[model samples]
Target: MSKLDEKVGKYIDAVKDTCGLEPDVDLLRKVTAACGPVIYQRDAETVASSDPDEMDRVKKNFLMKKLGLSESDKLDEGIEAAIETYGRSERTKYRAVFYYLLTKHFGKDAVYGS
Candidate 1:
């Protein structure tokens, strides 16, 4: 399996263990599928940009918009936390989904590795 698959699998297992319930694989798949195109687009954008600052901006924008939090006052804070935890890479899609699931199951503190 690919590294991404391994990481995601481990994350799923951890979530299941923490929650004392099996994760909904269908839900995880759906989230991953929905986020894939956005991740690909961000990859393309990253390749097209030589400026690190511009790349960061593009990544943050993509995360906020794709996650449907564009109008949120805490958008920047959320994006910052995500970027810090996940980095600006295609794998971020999986990380975002993992964070979403973690927050849903265990709350925000769990998401930040608390």
Candidate 2:
């Protein structure tokens, strides 16, 4: 398999193992693809949920800008739920998986398109 495919596989496993959610493989692949070369970088590959700036970026960039969500408490709640679902003890929270959870959380799979 290609490198990206391998990463997607790892992401699929992470979602299944971490959150116990049956991941949508196609959407996860798309989300991983959307993550681009960042997935290859060690530091940038995972999200640092403890960082205020990182959380802000997730809210503004991913949720608000990419998903076109309004700035509201619901956005924070969705993010928190995804983080909680992913496990607060888990250190390496893959960006694609996290985004996928958020997308699923908000019923914004349509944002990814069919």
Index of the highest-lDDT prediction? 2
lDDT of 1 by residue, 50-91 (tens): 355744554455434444334543544554454443334433
Least well predicted 10-residue stretch by lDDT in candidate 1: 105-114
Question: Candidate 2 — which pairs collide?
Answer: none
- Tell me how far the alpha carbon of residue 14 in candidate 1 is from the true structure, in angstroms, after superposition: 3.8
Please provide, for model 2 over 1-114, each residue's C-alpha lDDT reduced to its tens digit, 9 standing for 90 to 100: 999999999999999998898989999998889889999999999999988899999999999998999999999899899999999999999999999999989988888773
Q: Give the TM-score of candidate 1.
A: 0.35
Cα RMSDs of all predictions? 8.7, 0.7
Q: Count of backbone clashes for each model?
A: 0, 0
lDDT of 1 at 110: 25
